[model samples]
Target: MGLPARRPHAPAEGRARGQGGRVMAPFPKIHDLYVSRMVVMTVLLTWTVLVGLDVVNAMISEFGDVGKGNYGLLDAVTYIVYTIPRRAYTMFPTVAVIGALMALGQLAASSELTALRALGLSRRRLSLSVAAPLLVLTALMMVNGETLGPWGQRSADGMKTAAKSKDMAVAQFSGLWAREGDIFLNAQNGQEHADGKDTWLELDDVRLFEFADDGRLESIARVATAEHRKSGWLLRGVKRTYFEGNSVTQTEVMEEHWTSQLDAAALAASASNLWRPRYMSARDLRDGINYRKRNGLDASEFEEHYWGRWFYPLNVLALCLAAIPFAFGTLRSGGAGKRLFIGIVFALGFWLLQMQFVKLAGVYRFDYRIAYLMPPVVMLGVSAWLFRRRSG
Candidate 1:
């Protein structure tokens, strides 16, 4: 039979009538920018506030001696800020993923997301939209690390050293004087140089004396250039001669590798005794390990922190990612302050676990590559899936 007639939407009631029932009000369209911006702000602001507070407290408590030197509150502030960009860059992607998941989840609970779904927007499209901004940030983070992380670390270390020199401890380079018969070597200073790849000796001069077995002075040789080498010092432009019984037996030479009992690490320790675990870069750590390893040096202690460098950024990212699932609903229903307490706990736990894992890996002579890869694999996989499903 011909249709009796379609019921018209109620013109007077301002509602659409459909076969199913009544058409609900159209849902608001989800905006990509709005979601990403909100997430970025929340994560960045939270991280900065929390980290900044911790930094201030740490400086006050532990930096008293360093800050009292040429370094002051201003220097401490500079170093802290310089270090933040690296920390923040690593923190961004993680928070972006988690925050987006969280922001979307909360919206879902409030029905705001449901309304968007009703408007013909699929969960997949919504996820793609939110994750787009994260891709851009990923690029930024890569560049930031390549540029800022290395430089900032270096600046912080220099100021810290000048702020507090390791001049107290006496060592081979600090006041090492060696005299083998007529050959005398006095190193005024020995410190790390050339981006900590090599050790340098500040030599005021050197004095060499030639003597007869009868205890008579035969000749004198003046000092020359003293530079660093892999084996040891490269002393150049040496002038030596012998004068006896109106006859001159003399020799002039330059360029020699001075492999002393003191190794490069030992030299660095003697002069620039101010290095800390946080000072060296990834490359520095690698080279340091190689130098010590080649010389049969027992430096498993520094080796622990050294191996940690290769995975540092990864670890940072992993911690941030692991934090995502926790923020999802762990405290989504709670007050902001309550959520933060849980966040801090998450951060501390992540740090401790990472530290212990790295240390254990080093102590037991575990494979560093596996250890480095594990955290990223676990955290990033879970976080990625968790965020995708949550957003979906």
Candidate 2:
């Protein structure tokens, strides 16, 4: 035996091989890069399609407002364009699911996933590979939401309002809520009124609840209208009720001058569609909460808004992770359209559940942090369970 026939171009006995005793390319970097590319590409494509549909729908809904005041067709288009970032922030999580599911489904359909598995790639590893790019995207979206989203939304609303009226004011479905040193105020409506040398913010049906340092209600002031003057706010047609031990004293005044720290600039900054929490940055939310706390007013709503904004990226990640198992199992053989449909259905369900939880939390007066975090925690738990089951 001539020292055993030497095999040409054959891998050594101890070397790892692919189906045969032949050398194979390193799968980790190659597969990871490939999977990341597929996910990112699909995400971009899905996001583009969804944004296009959203733009068309927005145009149709807003077109009726065209030609109102100075708001022409061009103005409407500009308003819609400016709001694209905000809408994209709202739609990101849905597209993340759709994109990841479609990409993985495509790979499964083509047997690429099967090949990767045969090459000793674990499902958990594959999941992480897919998640890495999504995590980066979530961070980017958070930045956009904090900066461009709010700015654009405010600018668009201001443009539309300015076009419609000389006074720049955005209509809110509910009303405006604000706070000063000791006064918590709710204005049913607000508009700017410019007269010669001065511009004033005219607030209608204003209610002010004055609180003491001990968190006791000192008095309630109801004004038919309040106007911002250079010196201070002038409340007209005022009815004030003082809260004392066991007895309440009520007095009516034709007009009273209200003095406080809240001014035109502060009110202008907070002037937004107040039916919902304003799209405030984390810093703004924190300062608002602190101001409310210092004034001995309830900061529950601000707390909720703060946590919701602060933890947005985590919530998005949880939602995206939850969709992975569905991609690998139910949608393994499905096409991109099927994946898209399923992703939409699931995304809608998630949104409904999240809204319900938030509302219920408010009704029950639960902790704001808990209320904001509950949905993401549940999603993360479900994902973990499904991932373990699949891996096991």
Which numbered prediction scores highest in TM-score against the true structure? 2
lDDT of each: 0.56, 0.78
Name the TM-score of candidate 2. Answer: 0.70
Task: Extract clashing residue pairs from model 2.
Answer: none
TM-score computed on alpha carbons, candidate 1: 0.54
* Model 1 residue pairs with clashes: none
Worst 10 residues of 1 by lDDT: 166-175
lDDT of 2 by residue, 33-68 (tens): 899999999999999999999999999988998877
Clashes of each: 0, 0
